[model samples]
Target: MIRPSILLAGAVSVFSPFVMAQDDENKPWTVSTELGVIATSGNTETTSVQGKIDAKQRLTRWHNHYIFSALFKEDQVTQDDGTKTTEKTAEKYFGSIKSAYQLESEHSNFFVFGSHTEDEFGSYETYSTVAVGYGTRLYNGETMQLDAEIGPGYFRGERVLEDESIQRESGVILRGAASLAWQISPSAEFKQTLSVESGEDNTRTVAESSLSTRINDAMQMKVGFNVANDTDVAPDKEKTDTMTYVNLVYNF
Candidate 1:
């Protein structure tokens, strides 16, 4: 299992150098950290936590993005022997980085992306992917914007079987993604993102929708829903997973 501290440290190490090297006169880096937690005691003991970090940097001709997220949950349950014990119910970690080179057109760019995921209780134990693609703004309006991208990529994944055996799958895939953002009001915003990767053995799709309202100059309240689906999975496993969360976001 991947620890949250390890993931946080890796993210900071990866971005610290670039952040420190930037000049004051240059465009500043935009970074946001979000966290949510739930805990219960007495009658039932349960704990859940989610955290995410997002960072973006734009230079004269390059745009870069970094993301890291983690989820963990634990519950106290009675065993067959009537003994109560705390056990982890869910754990997941995900990280991705993308860099785009700005073309002559302001809305078009070429990008290379890579991502990795680890899920202790999902259909897939681990997955990693890399791709190169061209992206462009499909629409730009006063209050909304849309962007899309497509490319060929490669992925490697480990699937868990009914017998608890691990099966490794690797193949080329076609990936496509789109995102839309709307400014609902001066202090509120809504965003939706979707992505799909299709290969010979399986197809994976993910979608997220979120709404955030500014609380202060550097803080916001956000609610989000996320879903992930796999076309093929073990007989004992489900093909889809969903998450709903409310978080506090700190931006800089």
Candidate 2:
């Protein structure tokens, strides 16, 4: 049987990459790295880092946005039997490319994007996923906007647990995200996001909000909070497990 703590780690690890991959660029590229510490079950701690590089270019009558992300996790958790287990050190990579076609008006645009994720866990297990989505944005003011998207995806995943038990599961996935961005001024902004995801034994619903402040033309800092509940996520557990996390972001 998989432990509860290990299940939680897997849940958190899967969705953490979406924080920095949703940018829309106008030929202005971006690159940045972030580091932070997360408290894993009371006294144990996990260090998380993410690096991103993105660029945008125009393709005739349409514009394309391309962003790539990499994430690394280092941490340890004490198991239920009082034994210490270092959660597998894993590296995650992600790519999202969005393209929009102009519709003669500034506020009217349409786009479709594909996102890919690959996870490598120190030779224990690896998984890959691909999702494609269609969305539109309503841009008002200089930076205030709203964007919504929906997608269907699939996962090709296999896992090998510490007990030497292996499990293979892959199924249909549904995802949707809507974000509202408010530019308070030239140097500050606020954002609220709603995301829904449904997978095999997991149906996750999350709400997040963030605040961003620019330090200069080239750098920005932000912080956000996420509240989520997982229903039927693990077959062993009958009820939902609600989780909350605080995150900080940097853009350069």
Best by lDDT: 1
Worst 10 residues of 1 by lDDT: 4-13
Clashes of each: 0, 0
The segments of candidate 2 whose C-alpha lies over 4 angstroms from its true place after superposition are 1-47, 54-60, 76-93, 103-110, 118-133, 138-143, 151-174, 199-208, 226-232, 235-252
Best by TM-score: 1
Evaluate model 2: give its TM-score: 0.58
lDDT of 2 at 198: 78
Candidate 1 lands at a TM-score of 0.90
lDDT of 1 by residue, 107-160 (tens): 899999999999999999999999999999999999999999999999999999
Candidate 2 lDDT, tens digit per residue, 1-252?
122332131111222233333254543333344333343443565655545555555545677677776667677767899987667565767677777775666444566656655656421244444556666675555667898777887655555445545567567788787879898988888989886767875555668687767766545665666565555323333233222333334443
CA error at residue 5 for candidate 2, angstroms: 28
